[model samples]
Target: MRAARFRPGACLVLALVAVLAGGTQQASAETSPNLAIDAPPSAVVMTAPLDPSPGTLLTFSVAVTPGTNPTSTGLYVNCDLSWLGLGPSAPLFDDGTNGDPTAGDLTFTVQATIPSGTKPGTRLGDCGVFDAESRSASTSYSVNVVPAATDVGPSVTDTVPLSDATDVATDANVTITFSEAVDATGSWYALSCASSGDHTASVTGGPQSYLLDPGTDFAAGELCTVTVTA
Candidate 1:
């Protein structure tokens, strides 16, 4: 996961390099970056939309600042990655070290691939940033994902039993086809029988058709009307 929030229209560039505890060397970074974790705001889950999919290749970064407290094992971190279509990284921690801001900040990189079966929506996870001595601080993260949208509306295509045709048979189901997926979410149309005799009508069938079947048969040698309205 990325430590910095992904801002829309902002360049998403990061640098992370895993390193074991060792003596300090000349830092590659020219200028140090701000602390990834702050007390007041308190670092939490990120807001950037990774837009992850199955087999998605992702890379991110994190920052660990130097303080008076330094543990032998370095820092410890906990975060939720299962919901992000991946698992946690190995030994989440960083050794306390300070590099001149003019010399650049020490940035660490994290990379992973999104697993299959991740759905399109908001995913939340936990993130814990522990101090060098194993003192733990935790936060939550959120990732919003959405699928590509194609703008297309549904329309009526064909209707059964041509209107105003004579000798229309009774005890038959009226099937209507649609141009696109209609009422896919839920019921968006109604079917009713409007004629001399009492009849019941309902919206039925798959996304395309609205099968209007009358509960009672049509009268003999009499005109009957059926209406389908959205």
Candidate 2:
């Protein structure tokens, strides 16, 4: 057998070998930001104050940590308000311009309101926290709806024909809507006229809705005013 010799050309390739004394595979990076709902012992923590008044704002946060910056982030607060079917949605906010909230810190806010009728004492409210990454967290918070120092005084909320109404039809029955309920004793319409023109309420309409037929038909051009005594 004859020994052959290799010649190096202009494009000759050389094999490169790397040897490690301790031969260990490299560790994967962990800078991917994580979505943290809140601080804890309790992940679901209350952001509202103790004995919060009805209509008080309750707030919480969706935080990111050890997060790779240059990321787009956002959050939302979801609550079912019987008074208002759905809460509002939020939009994303990016901090990449400043290279901030980039690696170890950043948070977004989610806020809700305690309904006016949220009874006095502790009430449980579950508000959802959603982040830009499509991750979600929920916090069950205890809110103390402060006792209404004063009675929930009844007030007119809406009316059928509208207020300061002009050119109203003579046959039109006045419909008044109240914020809360009232009995016949507390519910009455006092007409500007001293004479009781038949101010009768219709119970069938709804507890909050009262239809009043001003005793009799209006004298044309008579400026009539009706006030609800609740």
Models 1 onward score TM values of 0.34, 0.32
Q: Global lDDT for candidate 2?
A: 0.52
Candidate 1: tens digits of C-alpha lDDT, residues 109-169: 3455555555678766666565545456556666665654455766677778766667777
TM-score of 1: 0.34
Compose the digit string of candidate 2's lDDT tens values, residues 1-230. Answer: 99987766522433222223223323223444567554211123434456767777655444433212323345444443332223334321234222223333344344557677766776555545554665565555455567656656878999867877778776567787888876645456665533435344434465778777654666565566777764
CA error at residue 32 for candidate 1, angstroms: 36
lDDT of each: 0.52, 0.52
Each prediction's number of clashing residue pairs: 13, 3
